[model samples]
Target: MAKKANWKELMTLHLRAYIPALVAFLFLLPSPVFAAALSLSPTNASVRVGSTVTETVFVLSTDQAMNAISGTISFPPELLQVVSVSKAGSVLSLWVQDPTFSNADGTISFSGIVPNPGYTGSHGLTISIQFRGKRAGTAAISFSPSSQVLANDGNGTDILNDTNSATITVTSSASAPSTPPAPSTAEQGLLARIISSTHPDQTQWYNRPHAIFDWTNAQGVSGVRLGYDKDADGEPSVPYSEPLSHKELDLEDGIWYFHVQEKGSGGWGPISSYRVQIDTVPPLPSTVTFPQGTTTPSGSSITALFTTTDELSGIDHYQVAVDGKVFTVTADAGSRPYQVSAGPGAHMLLVQTYDKAGNFSTANGRFFVTGEASSFFDFFSFGWLAVNYISIFLIAFAILVTLLFAAWYIRTHFMAYRYRLNRQLGLTHAHVHKEFDTLKEAITEELLALEQTKSKRSLTREEERLIVRFKKLLDHAEQTIEKEIEDIQR
Candidate 1:
């Protein structure tokens, strides 16, 4: 019987431990639900005050088939103003709510659904939001926590597991030149007499495949010669032709310059010129490359190498933003390897490449900064645990100091008032005076206890309530004493 009892006890102990382990294993198992993510393209941007910036939102499905998505993106209205919201390339076929934006509140919202056999993979483009920089500051474009991506399953399971946000920096307009330089003397003189041509006006844009050159000389000059080339020089591939009133020529799509000279026994005067641009297509988009994930030490900056290329017009400039702050803008293609200083925290860096013809492309990466808390006041340190403790300590210290000063001031002033009232009323031991003295003593003791407690921990809820009660009692005693003094004076 003793052996059987021992065996039963051991079985009970084993079962108790096994039950929790089984439950934990079950809980750790993956759920049937799928995970989805949403992110912003060109996740960062920088613009000058009064300029505009645009970014696209995208949705991706990791494992689930998504049928519907709804989300709201918020921004700081003081720094950025919503200009427009477009759904031109959105993947969702059915629109439950059209994308809309408000400048007043700096919010953009949209909701849409895909038809049966719900969309999968990258849900292509979602929507594009345009914002005009209103001030010189950094602003975060974030998705509201309530945003949702619903699965196609009949239950409408929320599959949203992650969301990425974007940042915008509005800088002073003086960062870049605002206007082009004035025309040179030769350019001015040549531009004066260049008559109209069949191609297009001087310094104008044209998409035509051919150009008809024409000239006029009311002086009835001996001969007129013409030279044309894509280069700025007067020397053309075909060389100068004999005097001709008009000539038809086929030309490729690009900027072309034409020079005309009049030969009136002067043997060809200075070459007069006009220019026409024949850009039939937009400049090719630029490619931007940067480090994927980087970690930097505390109090240090991370430098991201960036390379870009443009086939047609060549790269013009690059803009970089870090953690939603505008870091720098380089006007030349040679400017590579951008860098930005960051405090301890996770940050996103973005780079934008622009071609000479204004076409642009963007690339972004995520990085983290790690470091220990430098001091008690360095509450912004990256370590999560250290920051929490320091924050609590600072808050408690502020409250304790404020309460002590208030208590001391109130006690001193009220005591003086009571003494003056007693003298004025000629009452050394009135009921109001006695009550005031009792309350004053209570308040002084409570304040002393609070000061002592501050050395240990923050004020508890009960202690805060007691402080409020003490203040009320002091106020009542003051009113009673004032009423008695007024009666005695009358």
Candidate 2:
């Protein structure tokens, strides 16, 4: 209209304007694809020569569900040697091919798949790899550009949008370089952030006598020293030379203070400290106090009380045993007294006390239990208790009777023989009897002296010799008298 236009030219202008608008509209539309990412944890690390460093591989499924992944990681073989690869707790449930690594090639490869439901997370751990620092240099742990992460979206489309690599610096010293190189501004910012990984945690209680101190490896660190003491009054004076994470330390029971500091080109950093308690000693030996007398009636129960003291960790529990069999174990603090029922005869009771540190002490006592019996033979049914007492009494009575008869017979026969011997040899019985009386008196005096001395002390050597000599004289006199009797009888 406005100039009745040239129709073809108007149409051309309209087409150009609409084409640009359509293109913009198409660009604004949302795409159906999603992006995923793979990364190595501890993007940077500092390790000492002859020591190992571990790095974990993680995956992020952004907004997509990933079903399968395959990747290769490469490192400089001359500077770092592969130690091991761990796939524990991986998200992938199935393996297309297990993770494999070669030290010669300085490469690691893994291929795995998840179930149909797939997995989506920000920190899906894939694997952890350990490497030994072989030389003093910098090494890069990188993923091959050809690595693939497939989405579960039917088409198996590669959704990997990015990959992250790790950098490690290996030093010659056990901790860090004696002379650290000038650090960048970023490293200077990290100096105050150094911390220990295996610090004695507030909730953890160590039972072993030895411990290992571990710490995070930071950049620009030249050396690390550990100072520890038994108290908290002042700074620790002891020094640990190495910064190795597996450094073994021997510690005893009680409270301890540990301070860790790092040295760099800028001098030593601030000391990081912690207070911890170590308990390794066991409680004192338990004491079992039984009733005054050992005897108890059959089918009756008796109680024994236990007492124990612990200085460091305190008592945790007690265990009781009767006749080599466990009777009961109790954790109640008030349950110190224990009781047991006996059938008959004898029983042995043992009690053990334990500390929180798993150390224990034991004490034991023996007792007898009497049984009821109606008749003499019924006593025999009570086993060793009644039978042993009866046998002992019988043996003692038999010995007494035999001694009485022998005494009578010896007195009569000896007097008759001696009468004949005295008449024939012109000897007097009063002379022999006086000698015997003197010998008996000497023996009695020695025994009295022994009893009067201190209970702990023994008889003197001279006193012992005197008693022996007196006994020999008595024996000789008896032999002389007997010989004369025998000769007279002949």
Candidate 3:
């Protein structure tokens, strides 16, 4: 018993001694720390009032890879005005929302997505903003609380930990020129006019693989040498012998600079470079989903989300067409819901998304609007006119039944009453005529007998008087009977 108690006490002492150590070990273990940082380069800057300074936005990653970033930057509009926002050489593959700035509002918003494998290094350029100092004051530019750095992980976890800002000190000075001066007429006459039908604007992007460049050879120009490649400053190296004024190139999808040098009488003149941007494949198909089911009451609302990315140039705009009424929304406004002014029925939401390169893909979405809360004006809508077939049929059927009931009622009631009245009047007229004829015949016979008796014997005084009175009575009766017969005929 003594040995057993000693062993148990030793075990208890050991347990009490190690419990604190175990807890400390657990606490000392390295915990996962997110180190994604959004910062502005040259945290300090200086410029005179009316002069311009550019500030760059960058994302710094520690060990984890980040795939998306979005933020709104705020500044003092009274002291500084945003000149422009440039996305040149940005590491992000696609712009979720095109960078926009407002000088009056003193804010800039940017959101973009990186392709697979994402960006992992420091100095991942997001955008550069040029600001003009408007007053002599210290201006602070910093990311708003809305800024976020999303990890490349499938779930898009936000790992943004720290955000750094910039400080700018502006002094009073004169404003710079609003724009650069145009080239002189003589300088413009020196270079050949370059034109392309397929890629008309050098700044614009197109999906056409075949790029046709046309130029007019000037006087005294014998030969022209041209180079086409990704290098913006490279000139024609190989000697050219083609005399044609046009050249067509079948190029892969990338930015290419076309450099042309005309061999004038004196020698090769200055090279004029034109940029051509192409993307043959359209943007990948996007699945537009609604949080609410495809069926929604007419009075309710539905939200649609479009998640699409372009490998090269980013999406520019989106179009939604329902019930033949088409409207457009920019990618920045893509988060907005499409207004459905259609009647209750199945509607095909024709969606057309266009990239910056003008490459586009057509997609279809369907939604059914229940007739739960329809307005009276919906009957006059074009969608109602074309699609409200059931309502129209019901109305037509009701009208037809109403017309049939009216015809039956008229035939049974009014027509029968008219026939009965005419019949009753006809019988009464016949009876009156027969009674009048019988009475007249009887009176005529009595008078005729009396007149014969008078002619056969000598007339007494009483007989003559009676005969006169009977004649008068017969005359009055005839007049009254004729009046009664006329009334009956009428």
Candidate 4:
């Protein structure tokens, strides 16, 4: 019985909970309670130059509308102008005017269905138009609901009067495309710039003509080259491309001009002309002067003066040679403008100058070096060298003779004086002469005895024996005396 009661209680709760839901579903089950309609706010508009104009269209229904709709509005090439168009719908349509119609009459239209309509909600459509007044006269344009053209509401109703008007005043045409500023003469000139020569120091001969042309507007030029001169001195114009080269023409020493022209699909561009001067005459060399009576040292430098000139071909170069050896010169070294240092002796210089047109001149001259002043020592030469040796020998001989005399004087005088002094001092009367005389006398006596004995004992045997013995004794004594004499002499 308790389980049956619980089941009955649960069924009652469920049934009560679903009763209100069922009633609400049945009440809101219809499509909508209203029909859609179209209307315009203000229904008309006005505007002036530099002012804005707007047109608005609205859609309504007796009850409510559910479907969404969208469409575009286009205008003629010349009529009212449309700046911007806006609409509120599920899908809004956008329109643009052709650039050719930028100044023409134009209009904008909008059509789209209402979106996300609730069970009891009413739906409406709105369109807003924006445009700029561009002229000084009256301009009119219109807009309307496109959906109502063929279709009618289910209850036989029509809501198509939602179209609106916009009035605008444009008081002037001065802002038209033809009112741009006109170009001046200079501005109308060629769109190119003048370019200076690339290298200022360069020059060329007319026979071997070479030139630099301003390529400021390379895009504007087609082909460029030198024109011919029939009247030799007249200005040359730009002609068709020619097979002749500057080498074939004589362009030396004169004023000249070149023509540059261009061509393109638009048309030919203006011809641009540039002027250049050609000079070929060489300058006169300077006068060369060497200082008189000058001589250079082995590695010293000397200077020479000279002259130079250039009327046509400006001075180009110069050189100085000493015995065919070229003296390397600094950039500014010259005779006319300046002078160059030459080696000792004579030098030949050739001054060569050239102009822009390749004209040149050559001049040659010589210069000398001055001899240096002399000192007394400078008078000496190899010739005097022999005298040096002679004087040396003479001095040596004199020294030798003096030494011999000095030795003899010292030996004789000093030795004799020392002997005398020794005698006076009683050291010893060294009778050297006496000693020598004694020695001589003794030798003479020995010789005499030997001779007498040899003569007296020639035939007797005992007497010969005695004489021999005596002679032996005498020889011994003579030997002793001779030794003593030799010691004293030394």
Which candidate's TM-score is highest?
Answer: 3
C-alpha lDDT of candidate 1 relative to the true structure: 0.71
lDDT of 2 by residue, 1-490 (tens): 7555788788999999999999999999998768889999899987667656778999999699999999999999999987657666799779897787888999999999989889998999998887778999899999999899999989999999899999998888744444456666644543433233443563344467666665664566656666667423235344444443334567765545566666666766555555555666666676667754567787677767676656555567887777667754665642555667776787788778887667888888787888764766565566668778999999999999999999999999999987887675555555666777787788778766766773658878986776678678767877888687667656
lDDT agreement of model 3 with the native = 0.79
Select the stronger candidate by TM-score from 2 and 3: 3
Among all candidates shown, the one with the greatest lDDT? 3
Model 3, span 1-490: residue lDDT tens = 9999999999999999999999999999999876799998779988677556778998998689999999999999999988657676898779888787778888999899999898999888888877778898899999999899999888988999899999998766443432234545443444767899999998788888899998887776777888787655467775676544778999987667787877765666767778898877676666777766788877666567665655566678888887888888888886565555566778887878888888888887788888654556655675667668878899999999999999999989987887887677678767866886787688778878878987798778887787789778877876886677567555
Ranking by TM-score: 3, 2, 1, 4
Q: After superposition, how far is residue 399 of candidate 4 from its true place, in Å?
A: 49
TM-scores for candidates 1 onward, in order: 0.35, 0.36, 0.41, 0.27
Clashing pairs in 2: none
Could you tell me which residue pairs clash in candidate 1?
224-243
Q: Provide the overall lDDT of each model, using Cα atoms, as 2-decimal numbers.
A: 0.71, 0.73, 0.79, 0.47
Residue-level lDDT for 244 in candidate 2? 36
TM-score of 1: 0.35
Name the regions of candidate 1 deviating beyond 4 angstroms: 1-33, 176-490
Give the per-residue lDDT digits (tens) of candidate 1, residues 132-194.
788888899899999999999888999999999998988876645533355454433323256
1 versus 2: better TM-score goes to: 2
* Runs off by more than 4 Å, candidate 2: 1-24, 27-33, 174-176, 179-490
Q: How much is 254 displaced in model 4, in angstroms?
A: 3.0
Deviation of model 1 at 460, angstroms: 99
What's the true lDDT of residue 255 in model 1? Answer: 54
Global CA lDDT computed for model 2: 0.73
